[model samples]
Target chain A: MTASGGPAVRLVTGTVLDADGAPVAGASVHLADGPVPLPDIAALTGPDGRFSFPVGADGVYTVACRTADGRGARAAVAVGPAGAPPVELRPG
Target chain B: MTNGPHTAVSNQPVEITAPAAEQAVFEGPSEGAQGGSPAAFTSDGLEQVAGHTRALSESVPAEAWTAPSAPLPDIGEASFGPPDMLETVHGPDDRVQITDTAAYPWRVNASLLITAADNSQWIGTGWFIGPHTLVTAGHVVHIKHSGVPGRDGWVKSIQVMPGRNGTFLPFGAVTSTNFRSVTGWTADGDENFDYGAIVIPTELGAVTGWFGFGSWPDADLLKTSVNISGYPGDQPPGTQWYDGRGVSSVNPLKVFYDIDTAGGQSGSAVYRIHNGGRYGIAVHAYGGLTTNSGTRITKAVFDNLVLWKA
Candidate 1:
């Protein structure tokens, strides 16, 4: 959340799951926007397969998640002024 | 003159005069396809040749085979900041990218295509240091203990292609009649002494300008910016990638930098521009979590380069 006296920025949370709906730990999640630099936000899913990033503004972003052996998924999310909803990415 | 296989001597001048027909054969586009034949040397023969070469390297003085101690300062950790990702053109921070070698004419011809003996293909970067000589990583041409637990030796055959851009072969590939390396790497697998040379047919270097190699003190290297361009496996097979960064640290025989690299870039030249010319100061090898390393050229290595260039 931003410090200024505006609508508070929310935390973007998500979970990574394998094909069998099992939590996928150690998966890499990368978020990027055209205006933002590459790898603007990168995180590894915790043991519970959950991860989060703080977003201050509203915009479209490309989020990609991949496993150690190069298998994973990607998606485009549109964030509103309020914030974005939780995301669940599953390996194909 | 016959184009048959010729032996190489450590201190003697190597002269190769291929027959006109053989030269024409190498000039063809399909030369790379001429590997598999019953007449080609067997794996056993290749191993014997590698053993002999290893013996020759053993004759060198002991002091020439040294490396920097482990646990290097500030750069010793195996894994650091971001996960080490392998991809084409795009690096972790988008700081590194693929290079169009054609734009850099000097570097275009300086790169090479290395084909090993087992026909197990790999992209090894090399640069010409003389009219008939090329410098590359020793492990590219020969890897001990490469296969089954006990079976290990030199590769049967090796071919070099200069200025190879994807399917475009500006300069055709040529097989090396002679290959040389230091005993420290071939015999002991010392990464810090992983340097080797190839003696190609004469006149090739004249067409493609070569880079001068020298050893500068670690102090001066710390103050200079280094650039490395090579064929990384992550990119389209033969394409070259470029990474430039300041020195992170240096030990007696190795140079460590923050430059990005991948598998096939092992033999790339780690060089700096000086006096309006590019000079290679190390043979790039070893990719780590935070930094990459190379064998720092020393006086003994420089002398060996001169000898190989002969």
Candidate 2:
């Protein structure tokens, strides 16, 4: 369930990894099973292989990196509500 | 390029070229017949609530060929390896044809193909790793068509179609026993580690050539060149898929090049060129930013020393 009545917006940050452990930068991060990537939400990992997204709703959402191109980590992470911790994706 | 903090290199941007899309997909079959376009998949396509996701497919019309180079400036032509013997277009029934060696030459009997969990819809791509082991992009197996959520979006079923060209082989089918995401991908969601390997139950027919793996961390300093090959939809109509090559970018973190890639080109192998040996390092995943009117970026294998090997 999502935390209502709160003014705080949801913040999600995570590092995408491949089967082996490494930082995958410049990967395309999208909200899985939810809103469209373009307007709804989307981000690319920084040089340090990090990404962050703002969320306002709560549900069983999937975060995916569509292609493992320059970015090596191709994973699907789950994001919760405002008070929840960011989901971690383990590429296999 | 020497492997070091990318910032330490001369800030001057090197003259890199992107492979032209027109020339790459020219002689090959239609993209539609290959797979659906990831660039075109829209938000409306993901509107489904929860159910078996629809399989996305697209055709590559011969007319869609854009010519020697793509309309983009930085784009170049697809690189080729040894001369190939592919020459058939659509098969007799208008379906794709299949051949081993000469008429339909391939290094191995197995051509890597991936499928969704439900198996309602399917897409195909070729792999050139181990005989019983096949490789593909993590996204290919993880993301379903309908935007539906599974038990953690894990793939329920995956089949490898070796010697497949729209026809089933007499040896029967090969099912994957175990699937493992390469370690680099498990650690990061970047282009450097976008590869995954699957262990097949048996050998994929008459296995021809097997690519050997090399270590990236062990690679020498300075610019390193590599050859990339796959069924990029650019081979002549009826012949089996041909191969292409590119001088691997000398840059670190962002290894850009002008290789011929399309929807089905994902998971193709990127080889390190060293003393006449083709050492497999990374797998092809996606196109990069456009550099010239015809050039584009390609994501290849990285983190060889780190990827979880079978």
**DockQ score of each predicted structure, in the order shown:** 0.02, 0.03
Give a tens-digit lDDT track for model 1, residues B162-190: 76676566666777747777666665555
lDDT scores in order: 0.54, 0.36
lDDT tens digits, residue span B1-310, model 2: 2222111111114422323232221111111111222111123221111221222111234377322322121121233122221111111111122343221123332344443454322233435454455555544444312222331133445565544443434334676635545323333232333445555666542243344454454234123434343433322211234323233343333333344343344455555434333445555554432210010112223222122222
lDDT score for residue B268 of model 2: 52
Top candidate (TM-score) = 1
TM-score for every candidate vs. truth? 0.56, 0.43
True contacts kept of 1: 0.00
Q: Candidate 1 falls in which docking quality class? A: incorrect
For each candidate in turn, give its C-alpha RMSD to the true structure in angstroms. 19.3, 18.8
Question: What TM-scores result for chain A when each predicted structure is judged separately against the true chain A?
Answer: 0.77, 0.62
